[model samples]
Target: MKRANFIFICADQLRYDALSATGNRVAHTSNIDRIGARGATFHGHLTPNQICSPSRATMATGLYPRHHGLWRNGVALDERLPNLWQALSRAGYVTMGVGKLHFQPLLAAAEREMPESLAYWAKPGSERWRGPYFGFDAVELVMGEANESTRAGHYAAWLRRNHPEVVDLYEPEASPASRAEDLKEVWKSAVPPELHYTSWIADRAVDFIKHQSNRPEPFGLFVSFPDPHHPFAPPRPYCDLFRPERMPRPTIRAGELERMPAYLAEGDDPKKDPYIASGEQPREQGFLLRTDDISAQTLAIAIAHTHGMVQMIDDAVGRLLEALAGTGVLEDTYVLFTSDHGELLGDHGLLRKGPPPYRQLLQVPLVLCGPGIRPGTSLGALTSHIDLFATVASLLGLPAPATDGIDLKPLIEGRATAVRDFLFAEYHPRRDACLYNQSVITKDWRFTRYPNEPAWGELFDLSRDPWEHWNLFSESEFSSQAHRLNSILDQGLPPQPLIPNEVLGAY
Candidate 1:
């Protein structure tokens, strides 16, 4: 029963109220609030897909992107399903990943321009090509943002081998253009903060936990932090760490998009979308359709550069937990921290994320911490993100993974209180069919719908409108709780069977 030793990280788009132990009074994530003050903090987790490669292909195949087919964002994950990094590398562990594993499909790595050629690890004896790819035996890849245009992989070959004079500030014809007419919401990066890319993903995840600390198997790593998502760039002293008149601001109601769901109150039009009109603000348009054409001091300088990119990923999660307590493996390790969905910083008046399933884009920001967990616990039940692949295959005793996500380790060790009474999400529409949608939150309603406009939907009673600003889906006394949560999204999540890569051979 050795097991225990994972890492997980993940950041891109953050927003579970932008932390500070989830009470975020303008971001000061004391190292992600010390992992919820040392373990377990699900505050209703969610995010089965609110975009970003289909919620990171449902946390790498714990299914549900309609059975992990990646239903949107240039879809891809069908490299024969079964994932969680090849089931923790066939159980011997030691898997690895560095940053932004949007599990393939950032516009197919810019139509295979293979990130400005460093592909195949700069060839000529391809040094063991480092990766069993999706099941990631090893991978470093990084794409987009910080001088955009899919910012070349291997973090631009480790910024052309250790910051070759600011590796041409991440290219795009040697950067320099964003004069903020909304280049996706903000910008400033001239590449600093020790040559950014979130400091090369926390120095390659503290050099892969100092090269897998005395390796005798058991290791998992995943680090991945593509910033407080968007061109909201943050560098140098975390770009003036928060002070847009002391943060908060973005809620903006005013006829709340006429009670939402006219395909998100008729928003889409990032200049007639071609993926939001090809980067760096191509004649701006989707801050939920120009939230009355931006301004509250440009959404308070893009929420004060997204609270200085979440305090530069909470100071790279306090230097990867001080490199796992300086390689003593920080009490056998388990870590977790989350994000792969969330960002609308402007709430109902929107700023990012689409097809509004709101709750600031499907909640996100679970915590976790190590071994037997439970310290300072929080768990408001209703979890998701495919329950972190069945709570890391039930903390390594294995089995679980054919998918619809369940083992949240008995609801984070308090021996369960709730794992599901309702919490589902989906948005399968790559390139607008009005951004297709579906949702359900329950434990006080949140609804959503829109199967191609089922008379347009959304309900939100979230325990008396938790900032949803009222919709009541054409209320008539909440129409039998929106037809019993649309019949639990029409009896979904039950039919997972596909792990058969052949056997029984004596034919």
Candidate 2:
């Protein structure tokens, strides 16, 4: 068996049901679904964290957030950590990372600049800067999420240099009224599809694959798209693809938060909360949006816009597959698609991510297709984002470094039916910060506990309430079940961080 090329495509904030293959009736993801047709889709896959940096760090190092020490969004991932791309590079694979690789803080100050930060990339001669970053031999990065006005990275530079006329089209205030909808944070970008960041990322990856096809060594390409994350702005025709009327209403049960945890009962005002006001996340937008007060129309429009973004990403995925097929490496390359984390999408009357990790925020889509992978299979065996490093290393016949993840090779190849018995996920407000919460998800139950406030917790019977509308934490009838799950959580906890938490910037 020869070493195979790997094209790992990741999307930020893409939920489990975003793909048509994954039971999304509204989103047309034909290209992404093709991978599932050619391989398997892991329906039980869950992200280890709710934020970008921590979850992405888990993918890179195969270590949970607790073990990695990047407890929040703005913290930088330790470069010394043994990462997946570095392992591939060591095994003679040419490694390249394109688009949003949020391994570090994007809003870091100039004094403490990082490759992933806007401050570092905005400097002179930064255009010539590529990786050796977090194991990738080369990188073509795009900083920030959907908003392009403040974006920095190679993609932003390209937009400014070649497509100056369309730069203002990305700004919400400058966008023509007709081009955008009446709803806030939902718009049809006037920027052409070819020049959008989503397309730019695909274009770079396709070009790299075409060039690498002529080379001797197998290549590992990390093509990450920052879209479908937030702002819900899709380019041109994609933005008009979905209608609000056709979109599904959010799964919000009245008084859902009041029954669960006290902290979740009320939305946080960034101006009032000390942690959020001083935290790394941009204060202008507020840490988390309050969806409870928003009208149903707004929620529908948001979902519709989100579906449009998903469509654009699907088209981008189509282009990547075409590149692989055109280069004659389609059979020799493994194409894996996943997300850093998930968006709440108005689930439980919550908008955006943070606090009270629901299934909508924790479950992410995982699809794998390549040599030896079973085609058209959908496996429900529990899996984690941490499993990718070990699985990839096994596929390439390389010795994997010590990691918290287990190899999913047997499961994907149809040799086994299950990988792990349960999954664990966590979130922290800041580096070395308290008010942290952890959840243990078993086959039948999902239990979350906040270590800081031991009395406040969430417990749901996944087998009975898949949407998690009912919180069984304080219910005496389900106390025994909660106790069992709590024990599992205690036993399954990973080793504490050995390194001190380093503060880099506001997230």
Candidate 3:
């Protein structure tokens, strides 16, 4: 069989229910839906970690955050670690990334106040500058939301050259006086659709495909879109695409947090908690938007903008697909669409994601399309973002890396009913003490436990309460089930060597 080219696209902080295919009436994601229609959609896919850098590290290395040593947002990946792109490249595939490859934490340099290790890509003439980052032979990166001052890399350089007038919009500004008013639910970027980061990612991805279509070797392109995350600002028509009145409000019970673990319950106060601090303070300065007390109208507007961002990404996906078809590689290319993690979206009175093990923050959308894939199929098999490494390696006939994720090709080809019986996810806190939690999800239940605080945890009978309205951890009726799930977590991650035996054999 001939090896197929690969195009992996991911959106930042996109949730499982954001797609129209998921019966989301508010967000019209026709392009993403088309991918699902043409391939298999894994409905039970979950992320390994809930943050940007750690989850992405798992995707790249096929190892959990702990093993990879990037358990937090501000840590950098050990360059010596085995990378999926490096394997593909060694197998004679051209590797390229278009946008937002958060292999390194977003504000690492700024937060640590380092001089040599700048957070963004190095300048063209810098002595330490180099390409083929983290196994990617070429990378174009952009950090933060549309108006983020920290935005840099090829995207920033492109804006300076092509749209100099709007470059100032992305420049860093002073932190706002208070976060009480800025909840990150809704905002409008002065940037138009054509100049937006989503548009830039699509433009570069299409260009790369066009440039490499006639190459002798197969190519692997990672087209990443940084949007729908926060500062909920979508440009122009997209900002107005979803009306606030028509969007669904967050699922909030009167006292949902009352039942939560003590650590999680404390997040109910934005003024006291740092994680939920509204984006009024710059991330470099260590402040997050508080989602605890947002009003119904603000939450609705945020949802509308989030949907609009999804729509913009969907449109960009449409353009990239068109480029593939135009280049005559559409038939032979394999396309995978997913996200790093999910947003809280006002679910359970939370606006952003943190240590919580709620489904809204853990579950993500996974769509696979191309040759050998069953079209219009939905698989409920448990899958994780880490699985992409093994699956892609298998698809390309490359040597598999040491990974905790299993090969999902069987599930994608309809050859298996399920891949794994249970899925595990984790979050490690760096700045805050409360933001540390691990979860185990089985066919009928979701259980979470915190380190050093065994008595304080979460247990939900997902089969009965999918919304996770009740906590069963403290109830005696469900004590046995909780114990069993906790046992599974105690066993720890599946066996995965830090260095694959094959790589060692090369010595």
Model 1 TM-score, 2 decimals: 0.35
Candidate 2: stretches off by over 4 Å: 148-150, 178-183, 268-286, 431-434, 494-499
CA lDDT of each candidate?
0.71, 0.80, 0.74
Better of 1 and 2 by TM-score: 2
Where model 3 places Cα greater than 4 Å from the true spot, the runs are 109-130, 170-185, 268-292, 493-507
Summing lDDT over every window of 10 consecutive residues in candidate 2, give the lowest-scoring window.
270-279
The reply for model 1, stretches above 4 Å from the true place, is: 1-4, 14-175, 181-185, 192-194, 217-231, 234-256, 260-290, 295-340, 345-349, 352-360, 363-390, 397-419, 424-472, 482-507
Query: Candidate 2: deviation at residue 414, Å?
Result: 2.3
Candidate 1 lDDT over residue span 389-501, tens digit each? 87887876776556788888877888878978887887755345544667778778888777766688888888977758778788798899898888887787432222222
User: In what order do the candidates fall by lDDT, top score first?
Assistant: 2, 3, 1
- Pairs that collide, model 3: 185-302, 276-289, 276-290, 277-288, 277-289, 277-290, 278-288, 278-289, 278-290
lDDT of 3 at 366: 91
Per-residue C-alpha lDDT of model 2 across residues 1-507, encoded as one tens digit per residue: 458999899998899988888898887799999998999899999988888888999999899888887877768888898989999999899999999888887667777768777788768988788878888899998887665433678888888789887778787665444432333566567777788888888889989999998689999999998878877777768767888888888787777777887656556442232123234455421145667566676677678878888888889899999988998999999999999888888888777777668898889999999988878988999999899999989987888898999999888877899877788887766432334778899888899888877788889888989879988898899888888888888788732423377767766
True-structure Cα RMSD, model 3: 5.5
Task: Choose the strongest candidate by TM-score.
Answer: 2
How many steric overlaps are in each model, in order? 2, 3, 9
Using lDDT as the measure, the top candidate is 2
